[model samples]
Target: MAQWLAAQPKTIVVQPTTLCPMDCTYCYLLERHLKQEMTPQVASAVADGIGPSWEPVEVVWHGGEPLAVGLTRFVELLQPFESLRQARRVRHKVQTGGGRPITDAWCDVFEQYEIGVGVSIDGPRELNHHRVDRGGRPMFDRTIAGIETLKRRCIPFTVLAVVSQDGTGQAAQVLDFMRDLGTSWVGFNIEAKEGANSDGQTPSIDHARQFWRDTFEWCRRNNDVTVREVSNLLGFLGLTQERRDADSQHDPIPTIAWNGDVVLLSPELLGVRSVTYDDFVAGNVLEDDLSAIVQRSDELLYVQEFTNALETCKQTCEFFSFCQGAHAGDRFFEHGTFAVTETDHCRNSVQAPVLALAELLQAKGSR
Candidate 1:
């Protein structure tokens, strides 16, 4: 086998570009960024710096709309990383809002390279009411058109549906929409305040509990297509022996913003404060050593108290083994600090274990 990229980043999330055309009401990055673009040189530096050194690392292009970075830019950014795939296995993933069709060359990269994409479209029209562009128009039709393009071209893709408060009562309908999309896997994220989503309109605890129960039951019925949010738990229970606890407060995995600033371990760190300054400590990968930059930034005394508190949550909570702590940005936005236990995350994440046990007991009683 060829040598792996050296950084040991099992998953590397890069903001390929920070230019997004959508102006959704609940965008998490809205508070944190305007429209900074990631230069090809900076992207090349990031790829060279953190391409995994051992195991196959997954590369995820996250953005205001990664597609906004354009096909030429994407090609330039991906060239170095692609060379690694030429030698060994390097998985590439992109999280996009699906507002634009990828150019033909980009499609070639998707096919020629081992790239998987996750498109953001909440659900059907009613469920997607909040996913609109700046003109305050519904984007479901255009988003669906983009999805169809991927399907027609046989591009591997997944859907990430944000479950809105209004859509909580219709989990089945929303799920059905995803199934119709013809993807093998899908993710359902509860709308939380982050990025531009500052209205504090996450689902009520009661509703979230019911939604997860129903969603889980739906999965039990299907037995096929995978669900990202829940399967992370099932993977822990039935497969991996690694520490599966969400509350476990280990150092966060690394995430790279458009400017090449590295946010260790927390995906939420990208835009939780100033659009440019929040969660940022810099090393221009194009000019500096990525590892040295990480080492120095890791030493900064920003969230020590919060990290200690998270350790307590992991060690003490009943569902610690199953719950991953909310990203620091999520905790900060929802609870104001990384160390503070996120009551809502606790409630939502705790429901599955409680419900699973109840179902087991009911089955035993019936037997």
Candidate 2:
């Protein structure tokens, strides 16, 4: 169990830069405006840390904006992991805002590397008021234009929409909107109070639960599309006692920042610092060894605090068997400490969705 707990993540999130073209209202990044980019040296060091002995990993290209990093520079960062890709030891995905024009050049690169793409858009144009530019102007059309380009080039993409207060009861509207947009894959992320996003509203618990229920129904009725959250919810509901124990163990999701600094558990911990935990940095790929840092993750102060909080969760949170102290960043960003449990994320992403699925199941059984 100790050995399994100490293993690295199957998915590693790598930030290429801190420059985003659009500033979504609920973005958690503190350094999203800076132009600092990851050096090729840092990329090489990260690749070395993964090594050939490790299992295959999904390398997620994330940033203030991944596509905003420019094609040449983004390719340079990915170059280090080329061998892994060739060996079928690595897969890639990039989460982009699609605020800037996504041209054939980007599509060519996506095809060349087989990078899975995810675009962030909040429902229809009217609901997209929350996604704005540097000048605080809504650019919903601009994002749609990029999606259009992807479609023209026959590049498939997954849409990630934030389910904030404005989107509470409008799940069917959002799903219908996405259906017209021609997306076959969609994901909903509940906006929460975290990082630089202090004002993110938690939808009334009932609204949130209903949102999930409706979303699940939509996907079930419409055979062409699937929702990521629903998939996870279904998977969790099917877990056996032994399976839950094994899957409950936290994977060391190592997120490497532009300069190679590593943060364990959550990407939201990138720029946050606490007086108690100081910076939640586990180590730096440039200075410290990534594999060693992850292996000894328990030594970090915030991790120790999280361990204690998770123990508390077993006693307090009824969803502990499924959640297992799932979101470390949510706990810290919401309460300003990891020695706590039951965050806004816990309710919106975990409990509410779980209950919603159960309710749907009950109704189906009655039928």
Q: lDDT per residue, candidate 1, 48-143, as tens digits?
A: 775344466677888778888788787777887777777765678888886566655667777877678788988789888787787888888888
TM-score of each: 0.86, 0.94
Candidate 2 segments whose C-alpha is farther than 4 A from its true place: 1-6, 239-247, 363-367
RMSD of 2: 1.9
- Measure candidate 1: CA RMSD: 4.4
In terms of TM-score, how similar is model 2 to the real structure?
0.94
Q: lDDT of all predictions, in order shown? A: 0.68, 0.85
Q: On residues 131-207, what C-alpha lDDT tens digit does candidate 2 reach at each position?
A: 99989999888889999999999999989999988787889899998888888888888888888897777787788
- Model 1 earns a TM-score of 0.86
